[model samples]
Target: MSEVPGPSKRFSTDNSSFSGAKKPRKTVLDSCTSDENDCSSEEAVYSQCNDGRMDGPFGEIPDHLLINTIETPSVSLLRSSAITPTVSEQSFILPSHIGVAGYSSISALPSFDDNNRQVAQNIDDQPSHEGATATWASTGSMKTLDFTKAQELLVPVPSDPLEAFLLFLNNDILDLIVRETNLNAERVLQQPGVTDKYRITNWKELTREECMTFLGLLLHTGTIRLNRLNDYWKTHWLFNIPSFRQYMSRNRFMLILRCLHFSSDPRDEDRLTEIRPIVDNFNTVMNNIYSPGKQLTLDESMVLWRGRLLFRQYIKNKRHKYGVKFYVLAEPEGIVLKFQIYGGAHEETSGQGHTQKIVLKLLEDNLDSGHSVYMDNFYNSYDLAVKLLDRQTYCTGTLRKNREGNPVDLSTVTLKKGEYKSVFLNNVHIGKWRDKRYVLYISTEHDNEMMEVTNKRGQVLLKPSAIVHYDNFMSGVDLQDQMLSYYPCERKTMRWYKKLFIHVLQMSVANAYYLYNKFSTKQRLNLYDFRLSILEKLLPKKTDQLKVLKVEHKLTKIENVKLREKKERRGIRTIKEIVRKECKGCKQIKKRVATLYECKGCDGSPGFCTQCFCNFHS
Candidate 1:
């Protein structure tokens, strides 16, 4: 400079605005301003501007021109035209300057008006960056979220008491009971005397209401119909459900029918015809109501009924007077399966004959045959046993003392009463009437083989061919022991009552078997104990009177009894005819007229009095 400046400050006539700048200008020699270098500088500035890199001190150009340059020119051109902007340079540029600079004579920047708003609307219509990124991330990710765990967190936990109660019920137990009972929701809902208090609308919640409903259904299906459920409830050691009391009120007839049916004969056509449809319907209903895979035992029972009804003309076998018979086929667990009423003439047939007919009919009908038929000595006949064998059924019962032939000798044998021994027979005839011929056979061997057989009246009969044992006479200290077990007792007191007692005792044995199977355990029970247990629970308290009222009304009209008179013949009288007199009129020939005149119109008397007709008309 003319007045030499310090080294840090420099100026030139063309660069006077560069005074006080941080950098000092060089002399002509030091600057070395060649044409090639000048060309290079111009090219750098043009490239930078065209590349849209103008910023900070170099970014003073108007926004319109700047925008136009950016729109039209390539980034390389901008970078080559001028120096590339640094981070600091780019940061300082005003947003307004983005399109105003006319470096490329660019169009004006968009204003915040309708056209710009529409453009913005178009931009808004495009998919968002965040949304696109999310979609990409979801598709590209390797690990996935576990939904079950998530659902557990999202769903609300049950807070209601009823809902909590239901969670406690064992699903398996419920399913088991439902399948066994075979009950439908509607049937359960409509059970007699089922109060709304115990009605369950929601099964998921095991509330008191649900318990009541379950109990109601159970009672409806089980012994409730048989009149034994009350006994079971009262006697069973476990649960004491009070709700069953309400069911007893309306189902007495049904209960009675169940009991009668259970203990009656299955072969009596009259009873079978009357109840078959009902039993079939019950089975169908039970199937529909219950789940499959539940099983029940099939067994037989018998009851005896005798009265005026047995002698009615409409009743079959009305001719008989002494004995009445009822046949009952039941489930192994004592559920009634079928029943028949037999009396009068049918009783005259051998008990074996009756039993065989019934069993055969049931087999032919495909009713049920899962268990051995149990019977007393009367039903145990060789012919019947053979028939059962033919039908593929087992028979477990006592044998009649007087069978059909000469008894086997067992004098030296010390076998127990009701115990078996083998004996060979060369000629053993079988079957009813004369249909059977001689056959070889092996029969039971017992000490009473040659003893005289008798009926209840003690009438001795011809010795039977086989010496079969009566189950009643078998002795045991533990009466509940198995039938085959050894025991000791005097056989002298064999009577009908003893036999009957034996039958009752067998019921206890059967029940014990049932209980053992049911609970998968070994526990014995006797009839007396069983009956006592049942009575204790079943007997109503003195204070609890039966709700039904009994009324007896007599007919108002009195009827006279009429008796028929017997006809009698009198001996002829010959002496009374000696006093006959004759009457003559107008000298006509006349015969003597008797004091009595007989009229032709009437059988033996005249219309007038006998004296007047005889004396005046004659």
Candidate 2:
């Protein structure tokens, strides 16, 4: 068996180059300094024996020449083996003892031909250790290798830093600048000095108060420019600029207008105050606009006002002492068709009558035909109703009771109440004290209209069997309750005045809420809830002073710091104690001691001197 050269016996570069022709010289002796190991020398001698043989005379050469020539072929074999797969020749046989050893057996194991051949062919295929060994054993001479453990080292490709920085600037810096500047332009146009023509320019141009006022108006009008506001904030330079905080103030006049247009409740005081002056001016406006062929409901609203002298002098009726009354005429929807405010001293009878006459005269002078008038029973007398009828306008109201001196038709009286039964008269006279004959008509036929009128004792008095009858039109308690509930007031004393006011204010609030609901398309909120929500958002705080705080450094130095300190020190106190002796001159009074001073005896005589008193007295 031939021995293979170990790693220690490897040739050096300088010696291998100097070896002669025909056969290479062994350079191992020069490559390694001799160590005190016999196994290494033995191994080298064995390696020299297996080195390639030369033919004839060359083969018979001296040991030194043989060694040199033999080393070349062995080195060449090892070099080729490292780069490519090893091939075994028949002469290179393994020794029996060495082949039996565990180390030799492992080295002699079957090489991986199938699995590792695929791995070697494809650069991406990674082979396992067992696979590589099996592959080598199967293909050629067995050689132990761990190609699976090998790692492919990589080098990162370089990038241009300047180009990367420019990209970042384009996306993060330049783009941001463009957005901010555009918003700033918008803000500038909102400024006070900016013309309405240029109002779209920029956000920074507007003052904070101006911006907020515009926002408030838009909100009140239910015109939210959400997208526009967002765009301005995104781009405007002064988007986050601070300003002095102020509480939002409500426009009372606008609120009043809202009420007048929408509220069904007539008793809101605030709405009443707003409507009062407008009511006084109503008649004047109507006179200007009157060409009336239009239908109008003429009615009066009682208003309450406070004044000491007026109340005392004009309130001969005890009820009038608290408040004055006003008359208002309007459409059925309470539009203030016309109105008048009478003085407190005005009489309900003559004063109201005179006012009606004046109103009628004004209508006659300015208005054309086809107009109809509506009034309550109080305004409906035989004389006035007939007079209005003569003016080519129809009048409708309850008639006064005790309408007498008219001839009766017994047969027609049998007809049921609320049942239409009309009679045409050849000549009808509506005299001041006499009943007039006319056609009677009823609109609804309900059974309740046929009820008997009776006294509290269950005795039937007058059964309502006639189609037309004269009876007192009692003011309905249910109507009063409906009126009061709809137009809530503090008390019945202010019922009329309060109802009028409340109706107006509620109308306005309702209108505003309606507008908001219409725009929002949100069904969750009702009119009342919507108004409250808006009120909360708009008027977050009640007072400006309460909301103000000294947050700025300069402002803190001037005001808040000292005030805070003083408030902290107000409750502390200090005390001091002094030691003193008790007086000895005052006490030594005996038992009862009834006559200690004797002032009574001393009062009558100058001789009984009172100059000295007991110590007890002192």
Q: Which candidate is the best by lDDT?
A: 2
Candidate 2 segments exceeding 4 Å error? 1-278, 283-294, 303-324, 344-366, 403-618
> What is the Cα-based lDDT of residue 510 in candidate 1?
37
Per-candidate TM-scores read 0.24, 0.29
Error of 1 at 438 (Å): 25
lDDT tens digits by residue: candidate 2, 1-618:
334555555444466545454443332222222333222442353243333432221123332323233233332221111111233322234444532122211211122243332111221121211212221210121112121211111212113222211221223323333343345454444567856554243123323333334333333333222333222223123442112123322332222222222122345333343235434333443343323334455544433345332322233433334454444454342334344444343333234347456457434532334344555544543334335444545444443332211112211254343232322111112211112343332111111134456667988653332222232222221122233233232223233433344433333333233323333334546433554464444445546454333322110111111112122366744443222212222222222222212222221211111222332223
- lDDT by residue (1-618, candidate 1, tens digit) is 022232223112354442344322221112223433331332132222212222233324332222222223322221211111123323224355544222211111223343333112232122222111111110111111111111011112324322222222224334533332233343455668767575233222223333334333332332233334344344122433433443343243222222121112246634333233333443332222222111211223322223334423232322322332334444333532333434335343325346557555434422223223444443444445445444444443444333322122321234433333333221111211011322222222221133456768988743323322222222211122232122111122232222222333233233333333333323444433433333333332433323221222221111223344444577443332222222222113233343222333322222233443344333
Provide backbone clash counts, one per model.
Answer: 44, 51
CA lDDT of each candidate?
A: 0.31, 0.32
**C-alpha-based local distance difference test score of model 2:** 0.32
